[model samples]
Structures are given as C-alpha cells and as structure tokens.
Target chain A: MNSSASTKERILTAAEALFAQRGFEGASLRQLTAAAGVNLAAVNYHFGSKDHLVEQVFKRRLDQLNARRLGALKHIAGLQETTLEDVLSAFIRPALDLSHDGGGGLFMRVLARAFAEHDDSLRKFLSENYGHVMRQFTVEFARLLPGLSKEELYWRIDLVTGALTHAMSGFGIIQRKSDVSETSHREQTAEHLIRFAAAGLRAP
Target chain B: MNSSASTKERILTAAEALFAQRGFEGASLRQLTAAAGVNLAAVNYHFGSKDHLVEQVFKRRLDQLNARRLGALKHIAGLQETTLEDVLSAFIRPALDLSHDGGGGLFMRVLARAFAEHDDSLRKFLSENYGHVMRQFTVEFARLLPGLSKEELYWRIDLVTGALTHAMSGFGIIQRKSDVSETSHREQTAEHLIRFAAAGLRAP
Candidate 1:
C-alpha cells in the first residue's frame, strides 16, 4: 500500500511537469512513465490514461482552490453591502496565495496552458469537474452586485474570472523590463490586479 | 513564382488548422506538409522551419489587426476627451471584426492555442513579435484614463485583454443554458465586455 501511494504520487508529479512543459497531445504516455520512473502499466494502473492523468492533476489543485474561494465568499455573505474590495479579495486572494504554495506555481502554469490550449477534452473535463464551483462563485457575485441584471452580472463575472486566471498564469505582459526585483513585481501585480478588478466590478 | 504563392498559402492554411487542432509541439511538419498537399521540400523551401511557419501564420493576421487597432486609436486620439465607448470600441471592434473575415477565425483559434501551448520558443516569438502592439494600447489607455496610475492602467488592460481573448476563443462560460440564441449571446458579450472594461478603465 505504501509503495502504491508513492507510485501514484510519482505519476502525478511527473504528469503535472509534463503537462506544463508540453500540452496534452505533446506529452505522451511513454514520456510520462519514463519521467515518473514507472512502467507504462503503472500509469494505467494509477491514472488509467493520459486524459485521466490530466484531470487528476487539475483536480488536485482546483478542488482546494475552489474550496478556499467559496469559503471566503461564505465569510463575506453576511454583509448587507458587499463592497467591491470584498468581492475582489474573495476571488483574487485565494488564487494569488495558491501560486505561492507547494507545486501550486507549476499547477497554475498548467491551468493557464489548459485554458489557452482549448483542447476539447480538457475543456469538457474542466466544465464538468469545476462547473459547480464556478457557479457557486457566480451566485455569490450576483448577491454582491444585486443591482446589475443577471446577464450583466454573468458578463462581469466572466471577465473578472478570465482576468484573474490570466494574471495567475504568469503571462507577465505588464512586467517591467528593468532589473527590478521579483518580489517587487509580485507585489505590484497583486496590488494592480486588485485595484483594476475593483474598478471593473464597481464600474457604472 | 505562381506555384510558390499557392504553396505558401496552402502551407499557411494547413498550418493554421493543424496548429489550432493539435498545438505547436503536437503538430509535426510531416503532417503539416501532408495536410497542405505539398511535398516536404516545398515546406522547407518556403518557410524554412516549423517555427517560421508558425510565425508567418500569426503575422499574416496580427499585422492587419494591429494596423486597424492603431488606425482606430489614432482616430480616437484626434478627438478630445475620448468617451468610454470610443476607447472600448477602438480596443475591441478590430478584434471582433477580424473574427468575421476570411481565414481570420482560424488564426484567432491558433493564437489562443499558442498561449495555451507549452512551447517556450513559440511563446517568445509571439511576445517579441507583438509585444509592441499591446504596449501601444497601454499608452493610449493611460492617456485616456489620466486618473489611473501607469501600473493601474497596465493591470486593468491586462484583465481586459484576458477577457477579450477568452471571448474571442469562444469558451462561453457565461452562456445561459436555456434556449439562448448565439447572436443574442454575442451581442450581450460585446456590450457587457465594453461596459465592464469602461467601468474598470474609469475606476479611480
């Protein structure tokens, strides 16, 4: 049982790295097994197939991430007026903090790649597995911004979610070119994203 | 020369489709050449390498799109106190219009896939090639929103760009499941995005 657990962990670790380095089609089972120092049979034994492996990698991080987002939203739900800042923090803080967690950075990159890649199977998996989490956030957001129409609320939430995902992915389109410290850049990004999102959320 | 022109076009069409479907690393030159209905030597003669082929596919559409954006921005610049609508139109209309143009839709899908893929070489190529276009938008945005600091502008633009890209890619997370027509959805998205972005841009 102990050996089996270690083997499963190894498969997951290698799968995440491969998925991040090369997308779904680019990362083959042979490469995955080799990287994990396991046999092909072991991959099938642990994860069934590449698709399952990809799904597992995402589920590992996203399940926790969504829980945090929902938890934060629940904490703020008691307020009579959900300030833009409160809405922004509940969504952004969990994501940003996740980036700093163990292997969370790599997972962020993988998630970014998944969205950007737009593979049909991956998209289906994401929609199926995490659609409820997203809907939960949407429900909270709707309550927070009660004045906006249902359609408007959905659109704002869509844009806000897209922005948050893009920022977390490390695209760094806004990163300064000079020899600035990485810590400073992270702080700047966090502050800027929150402020920018707040403006978007509160816009007339 | 006539043969060469047709060959180039064929290669691009094939590359765009394959790249969109299979991503950069996943799509092989062998498959590309075969799909293009050209011999291997023809591809080598025309584009030199897979990377060059990828670059050419992007450049074809991006050059035109950027030119249009610049033209719109220039027109807006000539007017004093550009309205939120003007700024939003200048930023988004070109992209939406491009989607309607011939072969432009494929390029959009490919561009989205490029971001989602894990090829560093391709990512670097895109950033180096089109980074200036984004910077140009940023400069104009900063001018329009004098209330926002440069950092704030970048952050907002970053989110705006992400949402726009997500929409362009047709992920459709905001779609209502109950008998909603696509045309209405498109109109709703465009309108909602503009309002959301304008609010964000105008946010202090």
Candidate 2:
C-alpha cells in the first residue's frame, strides 16, 4: 500500500495477504494489526471485528469485479447479435483482470478459500449480496440458450464457476511463459477460458 | 465403523471425516482420536504424526480413485472407435462414484480444500504421485484430438478438473430432487459432467 493510504486501506490490504496465506481462521488479529502497522484499538475502530474485516476485504474487490461484469453484460444481454462467447467474456475477463491489480492477485486465493471453507455465515453473506450478479448472468444465458432446461443451465453455470475458480486461483497446469508479459497472459487466459466455457455451456 | 475394522482403518476413517470438516491445520489429533473412538496412542501407532496421517488419508482414497481412472483409460487407449465422450467418462465416472461410498462424500471437500490451500509441499506430493494418471490420460486425448496443441489440452484438462472438483464437492446450485434416488442422482451428475467436459475439451 502507498504511504498515503488510510488506516482502513492498510488494514484491508494486510488482511487480504494474511488471509490468503494463513486463511481466515488461521490469521489472528494481532498478527493482522502488526502487519498493517496499526494497533488493536485501531483495528476495532476501523472494521468492528475480524469477521467484519474479512467481509470488507472481499467487498473491496468483488464489488468492482461484479460491477465490471454486470456492465459488460448490460452491453450484450438480450441483443440478438450477442454470441455465447461474448456473454462468457463479460463474466470471465473481469475476474482474471483482478489478478493483475497490485497485490490484488491474492484475493482470488481468498475467494477460492471461501468456496472450500464451507463457512455457513460467509456463504450466506455472499449469496445474499453478490448472488444477484450471478442470477442476472444466468438469466442472460437462459435467453441465448433457449433449449436448455433451467436445471441443465444451473449445472453448466456451477461447473463453469468451478473451472474459473480452480484456474483463476493459479492452480492450473499451464503457467505463463517468462517472455510473455502479464497483460498478454491475462488476455490469453480470457480467450482460452471463454472458448472452453462457451463450448461447455453450449454442449449438446 | 464396524468392530471388525482394524485400528488403522478406524483412524483413517475418522481422520478423513475430521480433515474434511476442518482443514488439515484446523483438525487436531485429539479431536480426531475422540471421534474415531480410539486412544491417542493408536493415532501415533497407526500414523506417526498428524502430517503422515493426512497423507495416508489422501493416499487411501486417491490411490483407489487414480487406479480406477487409469484402469478405465487403459481399456480405451488404442481402441479404434472410442469417442471423446467415452474417454471423458473413463476419467470422470470413478471420481463421482466415490461420493456414493459410505462416508465418502466429504472426501471431495477435502480434495477441493487441497486445491485452494496452495501448500507447496502437498502440491508437489500430488503432482509427483498422481500427476502420471493425468499425463497418461492426456496422451490418449492427444491421439484422439490431433487438432489441439499440447498447451491447449493441458489448459482444458486443468479447467475440467476444476469444474469436476467444484461440482463433485456439492458446491453447485443443482441438488438432487426428493424423487431422485442416490443412484439416479449420481448417474445424472456423471452425465452432466461428462457432456460438459467433453464439449470443453473439444472446444474450437
């Protein structure tokens, strides 16, 4: 974080790195505050609790990521000319782009942890707030693929999400070549993901 | 567990359940022993330490799962008429079938956790021991679809594994209906996964 960044920004930045490394349950507030260069009272004053801080860490990125996705979707949704590939790009690009943001890459690992942790309260929090973004995308997917039953679409969407989470968390067998710049690699990832996801979504 | 089951079997069974619920770091030997209805000495005796026990828990299930996957792949390797979907079924079916085994459902969550954890030592262990299964499958895939480059094949396989891990962990929105029996639900999941994956692997 820049020196000008506030106490709240510093805390969230440190929390994302710690949570990515040590997981939410594993990372203590003392370690978190110490890493942030802030004291315990400052933490309490900024985020209310560790639980609240975790949510803020997620909200900071997800809010922008989802917003970009929805904005992209808004351009293509219900257009007769819109292709499956286009709809997929709207969904996949924003998430992959997050990996390039300064120190924002670890946030993907944090998101992957949320999926694996099976923490009931955290999931409920996600579903209640950001679930609508997915719901909207599914509606658009339904429009383009009229033959698929709602159940089938959900299966595809859920699996596609799995692949995205799995790959975006940097667990894939493929690695970026040293010669390729990060931006170039991100675009290739988007292209590869969009093609595979579009094909999976349109499977007979 | 049955009284006839050995102490090693009992400890392994209980360990898988605890590790599934709480992660490797989160679950303790004491809680694991208490759950298994065995003494602490049994844990030390059966598996030297918590880390070794964790590896054993993985090996017990993964050894079986990979053997089954490779066995299926071997049958179709040089067949004159096997379709891409057939090759995929060989890979996907056995992993999904694990869910139907007694107390085996939670193991998928554990596997999913392993992916998200990003622990270097554990990943190297998986790649060293189990990576060959995927490598063999990839060679078969390459012969069948000569159009895709090696890099492309790896990317799709990685994503498909992600989707498979994501879906099999019961994290998807699609759930078994009340009318669907365990056998029927499992079958449907296999169908959905194989179809989606085959399409994904063969994407243009």
Candidate 3:
C-alpha cells in the first residue's frame, strides 16, 4: 500500500479497535491518533470528524459484507429448488466467513456494540446503507416460507439476524478452554448455528 | 414505601432510562443522579458503584420475568407431548409481557444495550448473577427437544435469546407510521414474534 493509503487504513484499524474497546462516547481522538501512529490532522483530513470516522469504520466492512450476502442470495435463487439449507447458508456463511477474516472479528464486535447500544446516528446510517440487504433476505425468506404472514416472516427474520449478530460478536455463554483450537471451535459453531437456524426456519 | 426504599427504586428507574438512552458507557454517574432526582451519594449508598447499579437494575425485573418464564415452562411440561406453540409461548410470553409492562419497555431497551455493548465487567456480572436463569431455560429446552445433541441445543437457545433480545429492543426494521395505533402495533409484533419463534423451534 502507498504511504497515504497505509496511513488511512491504520487510522481505521486503530479507530475500530478503540471504539470496540471504549465505545464511541468513551474513545478520544488523541487516543485514536496515538494508536494509529499518525498525526491528529490525518484523521481530520481523511475522515473529517470522529462521527464520520466511526461511520467509515462500519461502512468499510458492512459494504462488502452486504454485497457478499446479496451475492450468496442471488446464487441460491439461481438454483432449481433452493432448500431451507441453501437459504440458511446464503444468509449465514458470509457472516461466519467474516468472523474468520483478519480484523473482521473486531468489525463484528463494533457492529454488535452499535446495534446493542442503539447509537442513534450509527443505527440510522446502517438502516440507510444496509437496510436493503436485509430487505432482500426478508423477501427471499418470505418466499421460502410461503405459509407465514408478512408480519410473521419479519419477526423470524429479526430473530435470525439478532442471533447471527450475537454469534458474530462471540459472546456465547459457552466458551471453549485454551486446549481447544480456535479454528475448530469456530467451524463447530458455524455448523451448529446453521443446522439450528435451518431447523428454526423450516419449522412447521 | 419507606424513604430509603423509595429512593433506591427511583435511582434504579432513572438509571434504566438513562442507560437505555445513552448506553452503559455513555451514561455517567452525574447524569444518572440528575435523572433520578437524587444526589450522587445516594447512588454510592444504594448500589456501591455503577457496575453494581446496572446489575441491580437488571435484577429488579429479571427475577419476576424469570419466574414467569419458569411458570410457563412448568405448564408446558405438564403435558405429555408439548407442541412447538407451547414451547415458544413458554419462552416468549414473559419477554413480551415485560415489554408491555409500564416502564418495562425501557428496561428491555437497557438490557438490550447491555448485551450489545461488551464491557468485561458487565459481562462477568451478568454471567455470575443472571446466568442461572438462562441455564434454567436451557434445561427445560433440552427436555423439550431430546433428539438434539448438547451442542445443537445450546446453539438454538443462543439464537432464540438473541432474536428475542433484538425484538425487545425495538430495532424492528419495519417501522409503523403514525397512522398505526401503538397498541395495535405492539399486539401485532408480539403475535408475529411468537408464531415465528414457534415455527423455527418446531422445525425438524
């Protein structure tokens, strides 16, 4: 990466980590600049303001994440008969993959904090930017479960999203000990979640 | 109510509202005291610290809520063959009823924020103090679905909790315009959530 591009990425990485650690209200610009090893002016020059900086951190991951979700959905739609498992995979695999990506786990943590805290501006930004991705899933889900009312479909989708988000945040009550490999645990988690979610979606 | 008892209740009520609005990190002791119409010392006197205060706020409603959940579960267990509907109602009714309770919605919002925003202290507090209630539900859930493995049961329960928490937080994407009556909308939401959750649970 070029010097300027590298600096910008560093700032974002630092900002996301600090924000996830201390939250938007608790994180200071000075701390962010210090962690990024960049001058304070760089943050202003690149992101304009702290609020804008926070927004960028989310958008960086969310934009790509949503695209992957949409792509997965589209691929599933093209199949002759999209079973419940296909639909579940499309909705879930991107999120699970993101969790394993470098720094992607931090991004998921940030997203969870934003959603859980209902930080107003962040929530609005997400709705405006990523709401359509969710809507697309909702439409697909409605089709998958033709018997469900629109209201019922929305409710289940809401739950599914919440569960996925929670799992992504890595805050499950059950934690594996140090002896367990992280990769294996994540794989097991993914399999269990997909199966459990599929059963929920296919329930009569 | 006694003066001290009333004061404690007032602080909790105020804390829940501020916490819901500004989140655990965002809402300060000063803000909490001001909202409660009490002095700073009252907070220290009543709850020892902010972390303790947050735990107390949750404890206040959680005991009653869990009682209701266990009560519902007990009713369901009395039947030889429990339907998906029965299992779902046992799980969801307490949460929905809490949401409908006067000022209960605010508490739900606060609880949602707490889970979304990860502070190690709060997480530890919840796991220590409130984890047993979750375990209680999990035990009942295991009995209902004897066919699933231990890992599978936990995953579904985790998702179910996540979805229910998200719904309670009022982050539902489908916003009802001013044209819809609030009562009608709430009823609609509860009915839809119960049905969706029930269907998902029943799916093989």
Candidate 4:
C-alpha cells in the first residue's frame, strides 16, 4: 500500500482498539493519534474530524461486512429450497467470520459501544449508510415467514439482530475451546446462532 | 421521606440519567453531583465512591427486578405443566415492566452500557450479587428443555438475555403506538420476548 494508505490504515487499527477499550466519547483525539503513532494533523488530514473518523472506522468494516451478507443472501433469498436456517446463516456467518478476523473482534466491541451510546449523528450515519442491508434481509425474512405481520416480523428481526450482535461481540459464555480452530469455532457459533434465530423467527 | 433518604434518591435518579447518557467512565463525579443538585461530600457520605455509587444504581433497580423475576419463576418452575413460554414469561415480564417504571427505563440503558464497557470489577460485582437469579432460571430452563445439552442451554440462555437486554434498552424498533397504554405496550413486549425466547430455547 502507498504511504498515505498505510498511515490511514494504522490510524484505523489503533482507533478501533482505543474505541473498543474506551468508547467513542471517552477516547480523545490525542490518545487516538498517539496510539496510531500519527500526529493530530494526520488524523485531521485523513479523516477530517473525530466524528468522521468514527464514521470511517464503522464504514471500513461495515461496507465489506454488509456486502458479504447481501451477497450471501442473494444466493438463497427467494429460492424455493431456501430454509430459514439458510437465510440466517447468510446473515450470521459473515459476522462470526468478522469477529474472528484480526482487529475485527475489537470492531464488534466498538459496534456494541455504539449501540450503548445513543449518539444521534453516529446512529444516523449507520442507518443512512447500512439501513438498506437490514431492510433487504427483512424483505427475505418477510417472504419466508409470511404468517407474521410486519410489526411482529420487525420485532423478531430486531431481537435476532440483538442476539447476533451480543454473541458476536463476545458477551456470551461460549468461548472457543483451546482445541478448536478459529474456523471451526466460528462455524459452531454460526450454527448455534442460526438454529436459535431460525426457531425464534419462526415462532407462532 | 427523611432528608438523607430524599438526598440519596435524588442522587440515584440523577446518576441513572447521566450514566445512561454518558457511560460510567465518561460521567464524572462532578457531573453526577451537579446533576443531582448535591455536593461532593453528599455522594461520598451516601455511596462512599463513584464505583460504589454505580453499584448502588444497579442495586436500586436489579434488586426489585430480580426479586419479581424469581417470584414469577417460582410459581411455574419445575411444574410438569409449566411450558417453555411460562418459563420465558417469568424471565421476561419483569424486565419489560422495568422498562416502563419511572427512571427504570434509563437504568436499562445504563445496564446496556455496562454490557458494552469491559470493566471487569463492575462485571464481577454484578455477577457476584445477581448471578444466582440467572442460575435459578437456568435450572428451571434445563428441567423444561431436557433435550438440550448443558452447553447448548447456556448458549440459548445467553442469546435470550441479549435479546431481552437489547429490547428493554429501547434499541429495537418496536416503539409503543400512541394508541397503546403503557401497561398494554409492556404486555405486548413481554409476549413478543416470551414467544421469541421460548422458541429459541426450544430449538434443536
């Protein structure tokens, strides 16, 4: 990568860790810059402002994560043979994979912090940029669970999303055994989440 | 109420709002005292320290919440006639009720912040004080869902806890309609959570 790209990458990486550790509001620009080994000017030059930097931090991961989810959903969304489990796996596996990725786990913590902190602008940024991903998945979920009213469907999806976010953020007790490979552990997590969510969504 | 008791109540109420708005670390003692309209010595006199104050904030709500939950669970737990929905309603209804209680809703947001922030001592405090509530519920859950392995049971329970926490914190999109009464809204919420959680727990 070019020097500029590398610097931005470094800032993003350090910012993710600090943000995960000390939240969006708690982590100041000076601390973030010092951690990144970049000066305040570099942060300003690259990301423009702390709020923008926060947005970039989310954008970098979510853009790719949502794309993978959308791609996976497209493969089975409306197909006759598509089971609820298939739809759930498409939605869940990518997030589990991201949680296992280097620094990606930290990002989940940051995302959880975002959920915890009711910063309206950050929320709007997230909804504006990534709302469509959730909307599309909801569409497929609606098609599958035709008996559910729109309100009921939204509630279940929200609950499922919460569960998935919680699990992926490592808030659960199911830590990977030392013997299990990352891939295997992630696969197990996806299986567990998909099974539980499918059943929850399919509730009468 | 006596002067001291009223003062303590004022501090707690203000603390809950500040903590919910700005997290535990972010909300300073000064801000807390100012918000409470009390002096620093008053906080020290009542709670001893900010950490203890934070604990008190949780205790104020969780004590009552857990007591109600355990009371609800006791009525149906281990009964042969107790369905999964019964157990789930036991676990969920109190939390839903809490979200509607005056200043109780803000406490849920504070609880979500607790989940987001990886502060070990606070977690230890919660787990030590309130862990039994979960353990008792798990016992009842295990008795009902004999098909699930111990590990599987924990996973589902964790997911259910996450969903409930997320929803109660008002993170989900399920706002009460203007036509709905507070009691009605809470009832509907409990129903949604109980149904979803019961189905998730009973998953193969």
Find the candidate with the highest TM-score and give its number: 4
Query: What are the per-residue Cα lDDT tens digits for candidate 3 across B1-204?
Result: 599998999999898888888887788999888988899899998889888898999888887788888888888788889775677777777877787786777878888777866778777876776677677777777777788778667767777777778777876676666999877877776666666565555446
lDDT of 1 by residue, A33-79 (tens): 89989998998888787778888989888888888988888888777
Candidate 4 segments exceeding 4 Å error? A77-80, B78-80
Predicted candidate 1 versus true structure: per-residue lDDT over B100-163, tens digit per residue: 5677766666777777665788788888878887777777777767887676667778778877
Best-to-worst TM-score order: 4, 2, 3, 1
TM-score of 4: 0.95
Model 1 has how many clashing residue pairs?
2
TM-score of chain B of 4: 0.93
Q: Give each candidate's interface RMSD in Å.
A: 2.1, 1.0, 2.2, 1.0
Question: Which residue runs of candidate 3 sit more than 4 Å off their true CA positions?
Answer: A174-187, B75-84, B174-191
For A1-204, candidate 3 gives per-residue lDDT tens digits of 499999999999999899888888878999999999999899999888888998999899888798898999999889899877777788777887787777776777788888876667788898898889887877777777898777556666777777778777776675766887988877777766676666566555
TM-score of predicted chain A against the true chain A, for each candidate:
0.86, 0.93, 0.91, 0.94
Q: In model 2, which regions exceed 4 Å deviation?
A: A1-5, A78-80, B1-5
For model 3, the local distance difference test gives 0.79
Which ten residues in a row are the worst by lDDT in model 1 chain A? A169-178
Per-candidate TM-score against the hidden true structure: 0.87, 0.94, 0.88, 0.95
Per-residue lDDT tens digits for candidate 2, residues A1-204, read: 455358899899999999898788878899998998988777778778888988999999888888889999988765769888888999988898887787788888899999888778889988876889998898889988999998999999999999999899887878899999989999999999999999999999
lDDT of 2 at A124: 90
For residues B33-73, write the lDDT of model 2, one tens digit per residue. Answer: 89888898887776788778888888888988898898888
RMSD of every prediction: 3.2, 2.5, 2.9, 1.9
